[model samples]
Target: MKKIVLAIDSFKGSLTSQEAEQAAAEGILQVYPACEILQIPIADGGEGLLDTLLPYLQGHSISLYAHNPLMELIETCYGIASDGQTAIIEMATISGLPLIPPSKRNPFEATSFGTGELIKDALDKGCRNFIIGLGGSATNDAGLGMLQALGYRFFNKQGEELGLGGKIMKEVASIDTKSIHPALEEAFFTIVCDVINPFCGPKGAAYVYAPQKGADEAMVKELDAGMASLASVIRKTTDRDIAVCPGAGAAGGMAGAFLAFTNCLLKSGIHLVLEMLSFSRRIKNADLIITGEGRIDRQSAMGKVPYGVLTKAQEQDIPVIAIAGSIEEVNYLNQAGFQAVFSITPAPLSLQEAMEPIVARQNIRGLVSQICRVIEINPRVISSSPSHSKFSSFKKR
Candidate 1:
């Protein structure tokens, strides 16, 4: 019996990492009943992290009445591990783009206070190590609200306290951290980040990413100015120019805030997830390793999950195949060590239609089945033409 390892990420809106693995396992076992299947559900430290990692830690979620950017009441979720030593927080869960309607999109009015509330809740539960996912955020407050929730104070020029969200940043004249949470000094904070955007510049959070969250030119300008204002205040008060730090722009300046206040270290989200899941151990000694995401393209070769897995598998000389919802630049993917590439779409269909949950699962099963069938007949067929022909000629010689 051959051994196969399935290490896959969540298919976003379609299948979870575990569900995807089981779907592939069921399909593979139907054809190759004797095959050994290893299921490793992986996450890139984003939205589906709870779905992928909670099971590993025996973690459960708790909801809190947190404040949104507009100071509106919203119930947000954060996870706590069974051991009560670690907590998982996805910033998007508290200050996500979806929480505010498109018509209400205003980076100036969004706040990270809800995320701060999650952290506070975790602290109350005696969890000292926090792994925070800093992606898909909807604010540019430079973490002012978060700091406030953690016992810092923000004041305006008139010595009056500022309000929540970036709109009030323009009025921020000073920050006082004398009463910060005592446990924060003892906490281990790891920020899972995807981009390396600096805090304030032409390519900064407000300038480059705010527009995507419905910030207009005016709102972008406002956020940019507000971030600059906050940066100056923090520099004067804390002697740290966090605005220029790498990855400081992540999650609408939440990264910078964490760095400055909570003493968090930023890391590649995929790398962190892989380490947590022991992905390298699973890839070792596998005849074949399969991994994929929602889409595969030039971007996949970057720090995405597929790229991360391929890099590790290549170290062991293990062959890998990618099954994506859609594929572009197949040649580029070939260079990334994908023995073969597959698209889950069965026919001509819109991306939305193809990404339908049930359809994606079935299509993934079908693709995995076909790949297994081909591999069974000729294991060498997984190689590309140049390599396959070279090996074939060697065999003949």
Candidate 2:
């Protein structure tokens, strides 16, 4: 491995993207002392986006008082680029399920109103270009609460404004969009999403994601029905049929509402992020690319971090290897494009022990060192150049 690239996602509770990439780089250097190694810290358009983007953006953060999932006040922040026109907002910061205690988790009771406040706050900061990261949600109200905060009114059969909740959506008769914030007309939104589930049905938002937010079987059915009914209303009022739109279910139908209400586009999470970070230019001539996430499973093939990185690496015919905290149901990963897969756990330790920062780093470094040794002894990765040190050169920026 002469010219190598390391682009790994944060290992969740263990290592951040930078830390994991550093660990892998250290191990690779242990074998190939003079090899050129490039590290690309990466995220799947969700939790780590703000951290990874700060360097590229040279930006400052703006803290705003916003409401949580249960409509309680809290202080959260968004990123503002040095140019001050671009703002990056993560929806999970305010409305994510993790913020609420287990005893208080309830999708119907939760609201996305706080998420809208973040966007509005960014607008007030004179940001016209917005990147919205949609993940880790706690609500199943079809983003009705968010729309409400944006000044879109939901009226019932008697023309009285309805309260927020998935169950109350069944009583919605019409929407009044004449009062939406003026800044939205001039703003552009790029939404980052991974799931392709639609607005309603067995594969839709409520049935596919609501149960995780404290919804029981009956509540899931109720929320699903509400989503179906709201889709019809959106079609009648906005002329946009989001009922079967891909990625419409993301963040509890937040994507669908953004599609209908804002001038925006939805993109696959990891691909969008990598494009923004100029990943292809950094790894154009790499001999081997190493990428991974917290877990590798059938779901990892669904446009997650490693799958997205592997897809980009394949364009240059670079062999790609993936490391994970654990591997499960990954029979098709290699077929999809990965050259190899390895788990970071060195022994039969429980998940909690494996996630220890020190232990995770040691395991990652040991595995990567061994893999480099194997590649070094193999003739396939050797370059045509006389010296292994002078194999390939790729731009860093």
Q: TM-score for all predictions?
A: 0.89, 0.91
lDDT of 2 by residue, 5-105 (tens): 99999998678899999999999999888889998898887777777786798999888899998889999988999999999888888888788988888
Which digits, one per residue and each the tens of the lDDT, describe model 1 over residues 16-93?
888888878887887788878998887777767766677778889887888876678878788888888899998878
User: Cα miss at 105, model 2 (Å)?
Assistant: 1.9
lDDT of each: 0.81, 0.85
Model 2: which residue pairs collide? none
The runs of at least 3 residues in candidate 2 whose Cα sits more than 4 Å from the true structure, single-residue gaps closed, are 379-397
State how far residue 38 of model 1 sits from its true place (Å). Answer: 1.5
